[model samples]
Target: MTVALMWEARASDGRGEELLAWARAQEFPREPLRRETLRAPGDRVLVITWWDAPYDAELPELPEPDGELLTRAVHRWRFESVGDG
Candidate 1:
């Protein structure tokens, strides 16, 4: 199993395109987008995503946003198979 940690604050300007591009460059067993859940907090929101592999595993870049800048801090984890677990 793989685990990922993402933490960040949005930038003053949006980063839509940049983020999209970054997502497009990722390499994984399946779709890079994976899944995401967001929570709105007035003018800002929180994003959570799951990945097939850890962050240091090496992946593609993400797209940039055209709106307010978003800051993010991310971490990833990779776990052994169920049998191993």
Candidate 2:
């Protein structure tokens, strides 16, 4: 099974592009099977990375960005494929 990690953040006032650029410039600890990035209307950025590992596997995560770049702390979630698609 594969697991997907979702990381999201909202930029501080007028810093959406800066936040996106910072995220784009980040390096993951390991290569993912698939990855995607999305942006929302409220200066929010979401990053999803799919990995070939068990749900409970220990994997490195993206380090938190500098506090000044965000309105609040980052949000993260993990999901495992159900294989019924």
Candidate 3:
């Protein structure tokens, strides 16, 4: 199975760039099959990592950033790949 973990955060006022830099700099103990990082309006950042493991597997995830950098707690979700079109 394939699993994808999503981590999203909203940075504090005017700190979007700093938050993006911080997220991009993070390193996992083991790399995932694929990873992507994105930024959006309203100072939001999104990171999605794909892993070649069972849906119930315990996998590495990105931790929260320093409280001072964000406006609210990070949000995360996990999904298993269903099928391709």
- TM for every model, in the order presented, reads 0.39, 0.93, 0.97
Off by over 4 Å in 3: none
Q: What TM-score does candidate 1 get on C-alpha atoms?
A: 0.39
lDDT of 3 by residue, 1-85 (tens): 9999999999999999999999999999999999999999999999999999999999999999866999999999999999898
Model 2 CA deviation exceeding 4 Å by range: none
Clashes of each: 38, 0, 0
Best by TM-score: 3
- Model 2 scores a TM of 0.93
Top candidate (lDDT): 3
Clash count, candidate 3: 0
Question: What tens digits encode model 2's per-residue C-alpha lDDT throughout 1-85?
Answer: 8999999999998899998998888887778998888999889999999999999998767767976999999999999999885
Window of ten residues with lowest summed lDDT in model 2: 58-67
Candidate 1 per-residue C-alpha lDDT over 22-68 given as tens digits, one digit per residue, 9 for 90 to 100: 44344545554454534334223334445566546664333334444
